[model samples]
Target: MKKTVLPTMLSFYAPDLREQIEALPEGTALIGISASGQAIAVDLDAEAPHVLVCTSSGGGSTTVLRSLTAQFLHQGAHALVLDPKRISHLWAKGLPTATHRGNVAGIHDALVGLGEELARRLDLADSELDAAPRLIVSVDSALAALRQLTRYWETFRSKDDPHTSPAVAALEAALWTGRAARVHVILDGTPAPGVLGAAPHELFGTVILARVTASTWQRLAPFTGPAPKPSRHSSRGHVIQQGESHETQAIWMTDADVVTWLTDPDDPQS
Candidate 1:
């Protein structure tokens, strides 16, 4: 079988590209360009509410999350980023619509807060009330954070507390219920054997592989058919959905670009 390849560069600053992205539907965000030069996008409100990005180190997983978060913010949504490394997506640090948590404690608190919000939304749903603005929780290095969270709980739990990590539990609940309430998670790394209940394919509606390999595909996404080989071009990836893979170039934007996009009120179209 023949394979598709992506362009060497897909500029986020191109005027036409920017226009197309802005013109996307309320809940849709442009992710990248397809192999045939079409604009590839995902609709969080209806399709693929949560996305999992599986990739090796330096394989552009962070780039995918950054692009999605920026688009979500631009669409008048709120973003919560749990980055234990404290280095991914630094552009979101001081943004008004974004909340960044780098430490294990902060990440735990944020997850708990989301759980509370989810409860409120569930209540509103029961009453048929309006939902809040869309919330995108992007977890950078999610596996590492999960491990650290487990250790943190072990060290800090009281005698009467439950054995499982509250943060993880909350996250699991969100995975099951948040789609209806417009709360979404964008996990930037692959899940471990026991993390997230080990059903990543069902939990994450969409999956993107930046650096594809046979073992990784079978482990993280067995139902997606044979894994597409890694693209020769760096930053290229595939978005697998419903047993089909769409070859695409990962969108790349500099930290300064993100800052300008957030702060420049005069250039709303920019």
Candidate 2:
């Protein structure tokens, strides 16, 4: 079956981070601008809370992450960023609502913190209390981070211990329990089967593909049939969610815009 090819560039009114934040409804995050100029958003309090974003180098995935993180903070959510590369997420550091982890150990610790938070929320649920504030765990180059985590486990864990690695266990625990506690995780990297264990799809409600190859598309979105032809000139990409697919122009933000969003109280000019 011939796959649908998205236009090289989808023309739409792409809103900056501040504009998107102002337009967001409570509990929803503006992800990007749809082809029809509508804001594409996901509900943080409902639906699956996990998001998997796949992109090649220079595919604008970082921009998506930045936009999403900003929106999460705009909604008074706490964002924990795990960036093993130590470079991509530098902008997120020092934000009051963000916890930035740049090393494997830091990532593991962050996951452990998330697990503890989940436990606390579960306890609150038992007490019939309201859900906790939303938590967004954004991991940049997640594939690399997972791999580094395994290495970290080999070095620190007992050779004879018979349990899942702490990093994986913590991550899986968050994936399993975070939805109920309003904790969302965003993973950005090339998709690799079994990298996060079986049924990785169970962790994510939405998947976004940017400048990926057919093989990567097959591994990530096989249900969509054949992969769309590669388009070198395209900044627009595809989003798959709840079995539906759409072409979207991922919102772009400049460094100045990000800083303004983080520091300034006034609305930024788009």
Candidate 3:
């Protein structure tokens, strides 16, 4: 069905998809398949909040997120992502981007630097964050580098009380939603307890889930349920999924295929 019985709340987490989808707040809408790079929300229904989840391993580095973010930016949000190599630079397309590489000294500088750039992008002079999704991409070397500073490393924070885990907690606070640009964290599954794939909250807009299957695709909502509703014409039948695959296999979840909110009862558009 093009539109669900009600407004849909989506969640996607696997190799445990079925378990997560069963326990949303009730009547939550989620969509996912073993295949698909990113999930998206494209509704003009201004009365309520709508989100799309697109999670995967490297989908963070691909155009999937860049384009999705560009759409949000166009919608007047300050889109943000934390890319390690500053690769998000290519996606900037001339939008002003202030970057911070965690210097060898202390990551405190990097965080402060990011906070300043965020202040500029969000248009706050004294660096007070407003309650809107302003896009901000804070590309850093690694969470470990920032947190586990060695004597040879430059990111030692006086805040590092050996007893307290400041770096881990600080990173978590920064990435939560309902704050700035609906933050997205990019990690190559190497940070151990703090990888993006196994995070605490799945409130992110989209995550490049994983590619464990044949030429794997991105998973939209891993923490939430992914309701793989067939296309409108085939909700009762089977519809072939189309698209090309490479570096990041590209696919389309058209308005006809995914569940949506009702703003257009006559036709489907994306």
Ranking by lDDT: 1, 2, 3
Which model scores highest in TM-score? Answer: 1
Question: What is the C-alpha local distance difference test score of each model?
Answer: 0.81, 0.71, 0.33
| lDDT value for model 3 | 0.33
For model 2, the superposed segments whose C-alpha errors exceed 4 Å read 1-20, 126-131, 160-163, 190-195, 233-235, 267-270
Model 3 Cα shift for residue 92 (angstroms): 3.0
The predicted structure with the larger TM-score, 1 or 3, is 1
Cα deviation at 181, candidate 1, in Å, is 1.9
Cα lDDT of candidate 1 equals 0.81
Compose the digit string of candidate 1's lDDT tens values, residues 103-151. Answer: 9999998998989888878777534534368889999999899998899
TM-scores, one per candidate: 0.92, 0.85, 0.40
What lDDT is reached at residue 197 by model 2? 61
What is the lDDT, from 0 to 100, of the residue 265 in candidate 3?
A: 23
Q: RMSD of candidate 3 to the true fold?
A: 13.1
lDDT of 2 by residue, 1-270 (tens): 234443454322242445445677766776665555555677766567788888887776777787777767766788898888888878777888888899888888888777887777777753453535678888888878888887887886786874566766777777777877777888888545555564545667788887788878877776887776544644467788776666676666555566566677464342
